[model samples]
Target: MPPVNASREPMTLPRLTEDPVSPLSPGTHTITVRHGLSRIEQRYHVAGTGPVCIAHPGGPGIGWEYLRMPQLERSLTMVYIEPVGTGASGFLADPRAYTVTTYAHFLRAVIEHLALPDVVLLGHSHGGFVAQRYALDQPERVEALVLYDTSPVTGEEFWSAAVANLERFVQRHVDERPEVARYVAALTTRLDQLTDEGATAVLRTIMPAYVCDYWGREEEFGPARRSLRMYAAPTRGDGQPFDVRDELSAVAAPTLVLVGSDDFICGPHWARMIHQGIPEAQLTVLDETGHLAHLERPEEFRSVMTGFLALEREDAH
Candidate 1:
């Protein structure tokens, strides 16, 4: 199928509504963006009077709930965007709308609709992909970037290496851990033939591999299941190779490339590539943490993020 031209469609800016007395908090607001045929709704959990931080969750389809860091609320206004095809957000009429570029465009519209003077972008995993694209597309709008557990790009080589690393890690644990062995055995049957619901289940089972202290602290990170079942199929684009290494140089926003020391998917190797690609980008590999470092190590993540934001604020002054 051909990709849809979003330009030709009648685009609607996001509608912002703030409750007189939000049950959750004082500055919480709901912003709904009407795209070509989809209405994307996001929750802006405004906490502090400080800078606005727009956060995007991973999974390309996952809701933003997991990315919520209550600790940072004291220092930053966190706007959690519900990407299209997930949560309160509506589905796109076009499958091609699932691409990274379309997501960036949608995000750009959100920022404009909100009329934010300046903002910081926080993207986790796949969210990092969209954040990077948006920063590249509109460098001026972004005050800074916080990329957590993501890579410069996603292509065959990256996936291949990631899978190899995961296999190695799982193998080492399989002998001593029966649960790990069972999870590995289930992969052959579940991964290749996955329904939307099945995909979520499979992900939850495999999430242990993504964290360092899975055996001891899995529950502390909370359940991996999302409130809404993600549109899994729309997320997997064509097998054609994808990479953004060439475009990284164009991103002018001060970027913080953060990754868990043990994150196999977007590990240190990929973090280094991103750091080397973008000019003046800072890299921090949090020790003993995995892909979900922010959730696993909230205080450390907050310190690292706020520290970067502080420097950006200083520079602006």
Candidate 2:
């Protein structure tokens, strides 16, 4: 890994062409980051200006499309990162380099490459883990943090509870919700045998379990099969029992921990754990929301996010 003060060479972004069909025009840029002994390209999309907020999506491998919330563009430039080994990004030679620490390092390289003095990191699910680690590692470079549907740690206790919750959810809705039951069973059975293609398929099948309005708003889930290579990367060792609870206090950035009340995976328990672990982090548990709170409740999520950003700016002066 490069030193904190390592000189970053300028990387040019692709020219943006006007798209009359779309309301927002985002510019795509890619930067090369040296991970362990392998060099990989990290792709990211940039939109809007003012202050920069780098957004990392969950799945560890999922594409950043789901997080391209237009409301955030009104106030801050949202930079959506496509982690290495996924999307147009370069493939990793060593899968072991897919650890959270490596992801944080990749983020730092992106920030440095872009010449961003300070940034606000918005990480969803697994991305939250990366953002937290990044903020802790580079406190001086991170102005604020938004941890959405993520946990401070993913140790045995967390996974045990998550499994228990899934089991209970299954037992309660198995007969009434056949789709949910099938998806849960599939995930439980096929997790070890997941392939790049099968990964996204399984994820889409189980999407309902992660949303609050899955029953009625199932159509809203849409197609999200883009990057699934990173799914296996995490399990390789980078995300095995991922734990960083003891390091939360080292983060100096103003933090917001957002989660859905109905998020069975990283629910209120993880949210409270993060809030209490951080010195003064704010926690918001959105009702009628699930793992995909931003997607499930865009209006409320936007208000909460924009309000926090505004407050952070207000306190700066």
Candidate 3:
């Protein structure tokens, strides 16, 4: 990775299929996995064999391209997957297929397919919703959880913030490519309808905090470039819909709730709620950061994660 430059926008995203080396450590394979299904492809980078770390991307149509998994992957065999219609994964025309519960099933299949034992499920934002559901469905499969900037409850507040962001983004695009902007505008409007189908595009816009500002290959303006590409992508078919707050208390895995003190969408209050509800969950808020705490504070992120891994290993004995 190049050094950070505050002047120019980042170049186009790196082809995630290529094997990229980690800066923190060496000896890792960053490759793509081909599932039989056309839309089932997953991209991951693996390092050590101590534990399996599976990460879910934040948005409906975005992949885990810019995520700071290299640090973690260098520590363990890390897996980061792009959902259908985003990143390296196959695209789908149906947006309704991106629901929370069905995503859990995908996660379960990935775990079983990989033949992993005692997995660590780490999710950010929307991924947290899926992680929560996965732990509820297959408690025994997960060894630990690290949730960053996730909401404990879902409703208008979430959609409202999403719509607002989309509106601003659409306005910027209107000048550059009116046709694409119009198409995106239609999708954004559909989001206000709040149907399962419309929610997918809106979800795409809501994710990817401007505060994160990390685009892997991009030295600067990485977040802005990524946000633009994400807006134009299509969504996947919808999946099952259900809230898991009532079921959160049943999560058996040791969890670490990592959050940004300045995160507006999923604020400290939500973190506290999740920490209070989960029997073995702990919350840590990063100061002076917004939604993407991991990127804003990568060293801190690794510190908390590595420490928790040590604690879990010690407890297992």
The lDDT of each candidate is 0.69, 0.71, 0.59
Q: Cα lDDT of model 3 overall? A: 0.59
List model 2 lDDT by residue over 204-283, tens digit each.
Answer: 55665676766675444432322212244433444466788898888899999999998888889988999999998999
Cα lDDT tens digits, model 3, 1-317, are: 00011211232422333544441122323233333343455444344444678777666544455454555655776676555555455543445545676567666766765676768888887788888888888888899998878876666665465445545655755585454354334434533235433443343343333343233334444444434334223234352333567778998999999888766566677788899889979889888776765556768888989899889989989
Best by lDDT: 2
Give per-residue CA lDDT, model 1, range 187-292, as digits (tens). Answer: 3332324666765665565667777877686345334422224446545543344477999999898999999998877889988998999999999999998887
- As a whole number from 0 to 100, the lDDT of residue 304 in candidate 3 is 88
Task: Quote model 1's TM-score.
Answer: 0.83
The number of the candidate with the highest TM-score is 2
The list of candidate 2 runs beyond 4 A from truth reads 1-25, 189-192, 222-234
Each candidate's clash count: 0, 0, 7
Prediction RMSDs, each to the true structure: 7.6, 7.3, 7.7
Better of 1 and 2 by TM-score: 2
